[model samples]
Target chain A: EPEVTQTPSHQVTQMGQEVILRCVPISNHLYFYWYRQILGQKVEFLVSFYNNEISEKSEIFDDQFSVERPDGSNFTLKIRSTKLEDSAMYFCASSEARGAGEKLFFGSGTQLSVL
Target chain B: AQTVTQSQPEMSVQEAETVTLSCTYDTSESNYYLFWYKQPPSRQMILVIRQEAYKQQNATENRFSVNFQKAAKSFSLKISDSQLGDTAMYFCAFMVNYQLIWGAGTKLIIKP
Candidate 1:
């Protein structure tokens, strides 16, 4: 089955540096999302994208966070300045539609470590 | 706001035995969806099962099944004939109002 794919399975960056996580959603998917899970914490939603725009975002998605669909297949999440607290497992997910019962396919996730 | 709660932090079961993971949620929306996802050591989130709130019948997928009580806002996962590969962190999630709410998670260990 086709699945969402993310690059840089693991990333290590210095604090105050910029980091960009990349994801290639399923070719036919229309909606994409980003979620994060701090070690030992529940997965938290960051943002959702559709039609090349952000549909929804959580409070944690503040000024430092932004998402872009630079190309038809690539979706990227950029953090202007990283912090220790930003270290977590970042996951990319996509869905064929926005239906209530539709399932979202998730990638293996990129583990972000800030030094 | 919608919140999903998986009270059990961890659980264990012997191979071939059965185990059930409990999940409850607080959602005001009547129409929604519930899902169980498994995160193995690799940290890959895999969808295990799903249930639509409007459906009365429980959803089952091979050895995995769900006891979805929509009125009580409870959803539980039951794994039958468990295998060592079943050992993973299970998360119960709910989708409502176009957003997904996740539970803390239950770490399940299947011993051989």
Candidate 2:
């Protein structure tokens, strides 16, 4: 089965540094998303991208965060300034459609550690 | 506002036995989607099963089945003949208004 792929399974960076996480969604998927799970916390949606722009974003997705599908296949999330609280497993997901019950395929996740 | 809740934080079951994971949600939308996702130690989110709120019948996929009580606002997963591989963190999610609300998750341990 086709799967979403993410680069740099793990990343370690100092607070106040910039970090970018990359994901390659399934080729045919139209909707892409980014979710983060803090240690021992529920997964939280950061943003959803469609047609090269953001369709929706959560309150947690503030000014310091940005997402870009630079290419037809590559979706990236950039954190302008990392904080210790930003340490979490960031997962990239993609779905084939936009309607209700659209099942998503998720990547193994990028573990971001801020020191 | 909508929310998904999994009351049990941990559960254990013997291999080849059966187990059930409970999930409840608060939603006012008449048409929505409910789903169960499994996350192993690898941290990969795996789609386990899905149930549409309008459907009266339960959804099943092989050994994985869901008892969805829309009026009761409850959805539970029943794993039959559970295997060691079934051990994972299970999350119940409610899909509404273009957002997916997730539960804290229940950690299932399959004893061998």
Candidate 3:
């Protein structure tokens, strides 16, 4: 089975620094999403990207957060100014279709630690 | 606003035994989807099963099955003949308009 690949399995960054998380979704997948899970908390949706633009985003996604599908292959999430609260496991997922019941393929999340 | 609830925070069962994980959700939309995802120690999220709200028949995989009650708004997962590999954190999710609302998750431990 195809899988979504995320780079830098573990990232440690200083507070107020910029950090870019990269992901390579499956070759044929069309829809992409970003979700984060704080320790002991439920997963929270950040944003969804399709057709080179954001389809929907959660309140957790604010001005400091931005997503880009550069070169039609790598989908990147950039946090201009990281905060201590930004520490969490970020997962990248992709689906072949946008159907209501389609399955999503997720990467082995990138754990980000902001100090 | 939609929310999924997993009543059991953790459960344990002997290998080859059967285990059931409970999940309930709240939503106003009539048409939607429900999903079960398992995250192993590796932290990789894998799809276990899914059900479409419009479908009356329950969905089943090899050793995983769901008891879906539409009117009651409940979706529970049953794992029969459990194995050690089945140990993971299971999350129940509700989906509508391509957005998934997740639950706090239930941790299942399969002991040999």
Per-residue CA lDDT of model 3 for B10-107, tens digit only, reads 99999999999999999999999999999999888999999999999999999999999999999999999999999999999988778889999999
**Candidate 2 residue lDDT tens string, A1-115:** 9999998999999999999999999999999999999998889999999999999999999999999999889999999999999999999999999978999999999999999
Local distance difference test, per candidate?
A: 0.94, 0.95, 0.95
- Tens-place lDDT digits, model 1, residues A1-115: 9989998999999999999999999999999999999998889999999999999899999999999999899999999999999999999999999988788999999999999
- Model 1 lDDT vs. the true structure? 0.94
RMSD (Cα, Å) for all candidates, in order, is: 1.1, 0.9, 0.8
Give the alpha carbon lDDT tens digit for every residue of B1-112 in model 2. 6889999999999999999999999998999999999999988899999999999999999999999988899999999999999999999998887778999999999999
Candidate with better DockQ, 2 vs 3: 3
Lowest-sum lDDT 10-residue window in model 1 chain A? A96-105
Question: Which residues of candidate 1, in runs, are more than 4 Å off?
Answer: none
C-alpha lDDT of candidate 3 relative to the true structure: 0.95
Off by over 4 Å in 2: none
DockQ of predicted model 2? 0.87
The TM-score measured for candidate 1 stands at 0.96
Higher-TM-score candidate among 1 and 3? 3
lDDT of 3 by residue, A4-110 (tens): 99988999999999999999999999999999999888999999999999999999999999999988789999999999999999999999888888898999999
